[model samples]
Target chain A: MKPTTSDADENSPDLLLFRYVEGDLDAAQVQELEARLASDAALRDELAFWKESFAEPEAYDTAHLEKSLLVPVEPRWTGSYFGTWIFILTLTVTLFRPVPVAMETRPVLIPAPVSTPAVADVVTEARNPEEAITRSRMTRITLPFREKRLPETIEVERNVNESIIPAPIPGIKSRPPEVLSPVAQLPLTGIKVQKVKPKPKPIAVARTLSRRQGRAIMRMKEKARQQRKADQFLKGNVPYVVPLNSENF
Target chain B: MRTFLKAGLVWSGILLSFACYGQVIPLGALPMQYNPAFAGEAGGPRFNFNLGLLTASRFRHNEYNLNTSYDQFIPAIRSGVGFSAGYFTSSFPYSSSSEGYKFSVAVAPKFSLKGKYTISPSLDLTYGSSATSWNPRPGTAKPLNLSGYHLLSRAAVLINSRKWYIGYSVDIPLHNTYQYYRYRLFGRSDISPERFNSYWQFGYTFQRSSESKFSFTPQLVFLTGTDRYNRYSRNSFRYFAPEAFSLNFRYGKFIWGANNAGFHLGMQTERVRVMVSNGFGRRGLVTSDGLGSDAYTGNLSFRYMLKQSRW
Candidate 1:
């Protein structure tokens, strides 16, 4: 039989190899191509490169092709190494990090009582029983509380003669005593009393003043007291108070 | 039997680590969930629609996702533009049910590396919202609804050849906020939490055939976040650091034609950890140490594409 080199002679070596692998060449052409492939080093390398680079088209029909070709190559350095290191570092830092547990320090404020002149003016302006009650409510006394354990004794100072008394009868307009003595007095330990100007007339004589004038005087006294307290608190000199239980005493 | 035993051991270790770690937010049907650069790299169809079903083993959760993507290559700039919209719903056996929707747009510009590889860089902006329903406590008959919005920005790089591709991406949370009605014994009030989250991922894809190809992709992702709970309440200022590591595998097939169909299967495992600190804005409280949970999930999806051009 004549050697059928006619088809193989027209094609390049690469094409010839592809045709041979695809089973498109006749028997004589296949033999011729195989002989050349065996003798040619470059041709062998080219064929090997193609085989490694491309898969047969028929292989696409098989689902298992990925098992051979598509499986990801093992990385030289796996991500798990870095991940584990990070995980360890994070856990260590979070678990061992220092945290503060104590309460923060805050400034405390204590307001001083109203001045003697202001108190006298407020008392004189109260004209009737109703006016006295209203004016008393307007006088604000702020006690600064501290977040600490309280002591047995709380030091509160007062004038011994200036006692809290109910308003006199509406029609009794006599000039009452400037200072009414307290019915009972707690024992004074280190209390200090500073002498000042005399107080105004008591609630009985103040009842003769007009109600509108009493209201105006009451508002002025309240505003002055609030301004003084705010200034003292801002200066950080206000006294701090601790709540005391009567049983502790 | 030896292979089975080895696999079993590996899975057990993963589960143990995950259980001891923190909570993980699931990535439903977004390819950007793996790497943002994958946005328009395939470049086959003008419109693609996908539907997926997923199940998680940790909380006995079932989830469904529907997504639609549109991608077009602009010859003038040698770039691609992609837009994707997705909806996701998840239900847990006894805990909560959540529904969310997301929309994102990406611009990808392509460059050739040494004429042998194609490199594409992409930026994606995403907006999403989620609502969760929590079962009523002991005395209440109505469920509580919590809703939140998230804005995310992502940058990614992808390098590809005919047979293989590799990508890396970073996602940053631009804004995240959540609000819910919190009921107390005496009254009900609104609570809004401030959230910050970011993550980075690296992925590799290998293809088996030239035409009608089958591919496998594996991804490694790292996530970190600081989530502040009950931000507006006094004596309730608490913040936690959440960190997670995830491994994901995907197998997909692409059928080439005017009307193309794609099928995918995915498996994922994650370990999360949360470290909580109390009294961030108050006094006399310390940070609390906490543990996390492990989760495993599987997903199956199908995609149909309508091609408008042969590019």
Candidate 2:
């Protein structure tokens, strides 16, 4: 069927020609439209008319018009102008008057240590679970006990009538008579412990180690546990900037 | 002749006051105003809105302001982009009113140091316009109106660590249309509205242990400009949990010939923060009667975060 240009529909020749001019028609549509235009003179005239209507007009010179409108207006200083200026002048000075300048001081920067090595790494000794738990529970008390100096030796003055006896100090077993210090002869009762004298014998302090060992272990374990908790926390959270509160002008 | 020169100086000061406020905006409880490098450093895309009201002796002297900002960090490019807008309006006792509008765009790229520290250098381009209307007599016809526009460029660098941050920023006016207006008014051809302003800020955080749910931060900021110098300090405390409360105290010195102090209290959740702040200070009155009058401001801010930061 031949479609007439006067047929008013969505796909009319006029609409197609308009779309074609706007480059909105697909390739097949373009081909069909072009074939129609080639076969019909009236359609060709309509297409040409559309083209002429859509084309942009050529530019022309407007120098004379610009020249006529470019005149500069002279400012006139009248009584009202003077009055306004004086008022503005008064207002500006009154509103923004100067004040005394304060002294300027710089802020002090306090630098923190990057790392602390003494407490960074703590080691715990191997022990039974019960012992470890006990050690961990004993917080700050056990640390200072091991740090203080214990007596190295005791001098016993002999009671001639008394028999030699073992010392009563805990964790220090009785030493043989031959093992006693050369400066002192052993008396069994009312033994007076004198100042800690330097001796070649080293077993006295070692004997007391068994009693202090448990406390030392507990202190280290507690420290190690705290360090572990800190490590876990740091691993999960990374620090970021915290902004300041907003202010008014 | 002396009267004219003094008038010119006073006019410059008045305009400079507005310019200073417009350029160095402290909005939304963030450092993005002074240092663009701080944009999106909080680890996610975020939006903020704030409204403020200022009260003084007279109704005409009161001021109102609205501020909003949005920023996002793009991990793919290791950079951030931000946009901020603000409006401010105030009236003078003498039948005159002034209004200002400001908009800015900022960009910053993050550089990592040792996987624990970050250094970001940023730049911002801002456009600002202010208009003023003067009517010598109220209810009069044909009031005079004057408006001007300006372009400003800012550069800033921030050094951020796990527990500390330091930043510095400088603002330079690129183009000012008010210089021509000033010349036209006073016949002074050599006037330029170019004032150099800079900010230096440092902050530190204190947390006893990771297990502890409380943290404290103290920050100090200093502002130096051609016509003014200001120093302020802010301390903030936050409780970490599903829901938390924050308290902040602030004090500033030499803010327009007045000592200023304020406080902000807020309740926050994982994704939203709402805060109310109040500031009170004394300002030299406009009448220049050598007497100071008290000024107060109340503000509210709402901020939302798209994602939670690791901190």
RMSD of 1: 60.9
State candidate 1's TM-score: 0.34
- As a whole number from 0 to 100, the lDDT of residue B173 in candidate 2 is 71
Tens digits of per-residue lDDT for model 2 on B224-295?
A: 554311112133222221111122322221111111123455444445655555454222111122112455
Report i-RMS for every model.
Answer: 37.6, 9.1
How far is A131's C-alpha from truth in model 2 (Å)?
64
| TM-score per candidate | 0.34, 0.44
Misplaced by over 4 Å in model 2 are A1-249, B1-28, B137-142, B179-194, B227-261, B281-294
Residue-level lDDT of model 2, residues A61-104, one tens digit each, is 23443477678677668889888998998966655544445444
Q: Per-prediction fnat values?
A: 0.00, 0.06
Model 2 pairs whose backbones collide:
none
